[model samples]
Target: MRAVTYDSYASDNSRLKVGRVPDPKVGPGQVLIEVRAAGVNPVDWKVMTGGLDGMMDAMFPVIPGWDVAGVVRGRGPDTPDFVDGDEVMSYARKDVVGAGTFAQYVAVAADDVARKPASLDWNQAGGLPLVGMTAQRSLDRLEVGQGDVLLIHAASGGVGSLGVQIARDRGARVIGTASEENHEFLRGLGAEPVAYGDGLVERVRELAPDGVTAVADFVGGQLDTTLAVLAEGGRHVSVADNTVDQHGGHWIWVRPSGAKLAELAAMADRGALTVEVAGTYPLEKVGEAFDASRTGHTRGKLVITP
Candidate 1:
């Protein structure tokens, strides 16, 4: 099978290369997917640089992707939930950092794969799982609901964009932080956009004078701002900063869950959610895709079609 692989960590991402590798084996409770598209994320580059080495063991020549949209080519024993030719998407992060989704084929645990939303094309579906699930987990942990005012930092980025829509669907008033260029984009997603950086606290206050009832910090280094603008007794969570926990907010990590992805699919099908794709790259252009992701400015998801 043709796939991207990195022999070892490199701060410069110099090790990523495309080559033929052994096909992934289907084990019990797993399903082999014929890869159609894969999502490029900051973590993919981070993993290449050994950022997650402390948490996940790596095998040499690691395949570098987690989000996938594809067709089930086969299923392992005891996996009765899907059949051959089923269209699916998954946050396919294994406990070990190898055998990833940036390939012609990938074998994912059945519990981690979900049927793709009918409304999303391959690129959108491929980009949906990780960012979508991350946003869902953050909102769920914050208990965001009707009558709540939610502030999301970096709200125009992949996860933040999805977070805005999901929070709005739950009846929360969403205040999203983005650059001046993306303010209209955020507004279209049902959020009141506030430009980040200096005066962020004041801007948020102007929108919600009592301060926001919840803050979801998708961008790190906003702890002070998060603390300053949160309403009294409000909840907060951050995917980027663990220090948030020390300030009475939760630091969350998204766990792979097909059930949660299915819920997101339902939201998409019902018109309550939509994925924004900034661009798409072919499998051979994984390096360029990673370069774009590292820029920290794309307004939506970047996808790789294999």
Candidate 2:
């Protein structure tokens, strides 16, 4: 199997190299996928630079990716959920940072795998899991539902776009903060778009004079801005800032669940959710994919076709 391997942690993209590696061993409750596409996220590059070192250990010669959409090549015993040639996607992070989705094949725990949404192609499926899960988790934590006015920071982003759509699907009026260029994009996702930065609070206030009933911050450093526009007794959550807890907001870290993934896929199938793939690179050009993700300005998801 060929994979992108990095032996050491560094804030450098050059450390990632493509080479042949042994195929992963399939263990009980695991499924081996023949990789079709992998989503390139900020965390992929961050992990390469040891950003998650304190939280999780990495094995040497690490294959660094977590989002995958592929075909099931094989499965281990007791995995009754899938069989050969099943199309699936997963947030396939394991206890260690090796045997990742950047490879031609990756072994994922059955509990983390879900049947790929039939409505989405490989790239969209590959890109949807992580961002979709994060958005869904944040909305869940905020208890966003009917009659609530939801404000999402960075709403044109991968996770934020989905957050806007999900909040809308739950019957909430969505106010999303993005740049002027992405306002129409957020509008397409059913959000009232507001420009971020200076006057963001005022802009959001114009749309929701009583203050928003909930706030989900997908971008960091917006604690004060969130506080300024939040309605009294409203809920708040942040994936980017742990300090949100200090302000009576929940800090969310998404957990992989096949059930939740399946539910998201069902939403895609029902035309309630969709993914936008902004850029793509071949397996060997994963470094370029990482470069695009590191820019933090991509309007949609970046993907690697392996």
Candidate 3:
């Protein structure tokens, strides 16, 4: 199988190359997916540069990706939840950093793979899992729901955009932070968009004078703004900032769960959620996708069709 592999950590993405590698073997409780599309995320590049060295041990010549949408080509024993020919999606991160989704195929634990939403195309489904699951986990930690005014930092980015829609679906009034150019995009997702930076607190105050009841920070370095705009006794969570825990907020890490992905699939099927794919790349263009993601400015998801 041909896949993207990086032999070592680099200051840049110079080591990423496409080449033939052994096909992933299906282990017990695992399912092999014939890759159709894979989502490009910041963590892919970060991991390549050894950004997560302390948290996840990397196996060199690592395949770099986690979000996948594909057909189940085979299954291991005891995996009764899915069978051959099933269309599925998964956040395919294992305990180690290898055997990723940017390949002709990947084998994932059955507990982390979910049926793809019937309404989404391959690109959208591929882009959904990681960002969708991140948003869900953040909102769940904050307990966002009816009567809450939720403020999401970087709300136009991959995870933030999905967070906005999910919060709105739960009856929360969403106030999202983005630049002037992305404000309209955020509004389209049912959030009242506010410009981020210098006067972020004042801007959010103008929208919710008493401060928001919950805050989900997708962008790091927004702790000050989060602290400023949060209502008294409000909850907060951050995927980017670990210091959030020290400030009485949760520092969240998304876990793989087929069941949670299934819930997101149901939301997509019901028209309550949608994926915004800004662009698609072929398997060989994984480097380009990573370059775009590193810019931190794309309005929607970037996908790779293998």
Give the per-residue lDDT digits (tens) of candidate 3, residues 1-306. 999999999868789899999999999999999999999989999999899999999998899999999999999889898989999999999899988999999999999999999999999999999999999999999999999999999999999999998999999999998999998888889999988878889999999999989999998999988888888999999999999999999999999999999999999999999999999998788889998998999987999998
Candidate 1 matches the true fold with a TM-score of: 0.99
**Ten residues in sequence with the least summed lDDT for candidate 3:** 194-203
User: If scored against the real structure, what TM-score would every candidate get?
Assistant: 0.99, 0.99, 0.99
lDDT of 2 by residue, 65-181 (tens): 899999999999899989999999999988877778998999999999999999999999999999999999999988889999999998999999989888999999999888899
Candidate with the greatest lDDT versus the true structure: 1
Clashes in model 3: which pairs? none
Candidate 3: segments with Cα more than 4 A from true spot: none
226-275: candidate 1 lDDT, tens digit per residue:
99999999999999999998999999999999999999999999999999
lDDT of 2 at 265: 96
Each model's lDDT: 0.95, 0.91, 0.94
Question: What is the overall TM-score of model 2 with all chains considered together?
Answer: 0.99
